[model samples]
Target: MLRRRGRLPAAPWLVAVTLSALLLAAARPAVGAAAWCIARSGASEKALQSALDYACGPAGGADCAPIQASGLCYLPNTLAAHASYAFNSIFQRSRAAPGACDFAGTATVTLTDPSQLWIMHLPFISKHCRAIRNTRLSILHSELHV
Candidate 1:
């Protein structure tokens, strides 16, 4: 009887595949961020003040949304939207807004649809929304309101 040649086992391939898979999984980009639904709404002028008042339960509130650029990360989407709207209630007014401020101060954004909205900086976003509003308003003021 002719002796059969001994074939090498394929264990290495299995290990390689498993390791590759793990590495691939680890390398996945911030994909979940796409799942977020973004929407915003502007609050009344000084909405922060109003919210504080409401939260305070009839104390006249704190007089502001209680947030800054760095603080945007702490605010929820809904809260941020309101604050943004309030800060920059006027679209045309925002168009002429200055740069590098806490919130944009003229636009309102809506963050909705997905409850688990993955925001990088909640406060920053809110601020930007306001800024956008301010910019738009400024433009309007220059173009029409003026």
Candidate 2:
């Protein structure tokens, strides 16, 4: 009997295995960008920071206290006016999967110079609710590939 030759001779399995790995390796983000988040909220960057701390995690201790009548609960007193219009780069929690960053809860934002920048001014409230609609704050995600 003559030697048999299959229509597909070489192994297609090897080709598939190689491609999957290359795709996954390239999918990860840079070490630096992956380390932390660059958040922009309120006018001063500090306000957003305080908000992150208030999340009540051990990682950032000072932020773990009960909201105080003194303005510690939300943006501080000095920053109130500008708070509605400011978005400063703050916290960093991976937004893709197991890690994520989001507004503490339902927030309300009002646009100050709605005409100029069209950027809204965020407001402080005791509680966050879904019915609330804010112009300044929003949920956004960048689909940039690694």
The number of the candidate with the highest TM-score is 2
Backbone collisions counted per model? 38, 16
* TM-score of each candidate structure, all chains considered together: 0.22, 0.27
Global lDDT of model 1: 0.40
Candidate 1 local lDDT, 28-106, one digit each (tens): 4343322121113443446444543343243323223334343323254445443433333222233423331123232
- Candidate topping lDDT: 1
Q: What are the lDDT scores of the predictions, listed in order?
A: 0.40, 0.34
Clashes of 2: 16
Q: For residues 1-146, could you state the per-residue lDDT of candidate 2 as single tens digits?
A: 34357534346657777899889866665444432222333434565545454443354332222233332234333343222212211232223232333434212322222223222222232222112323112422223332
Error of 2 at 38 (Å): 2.5
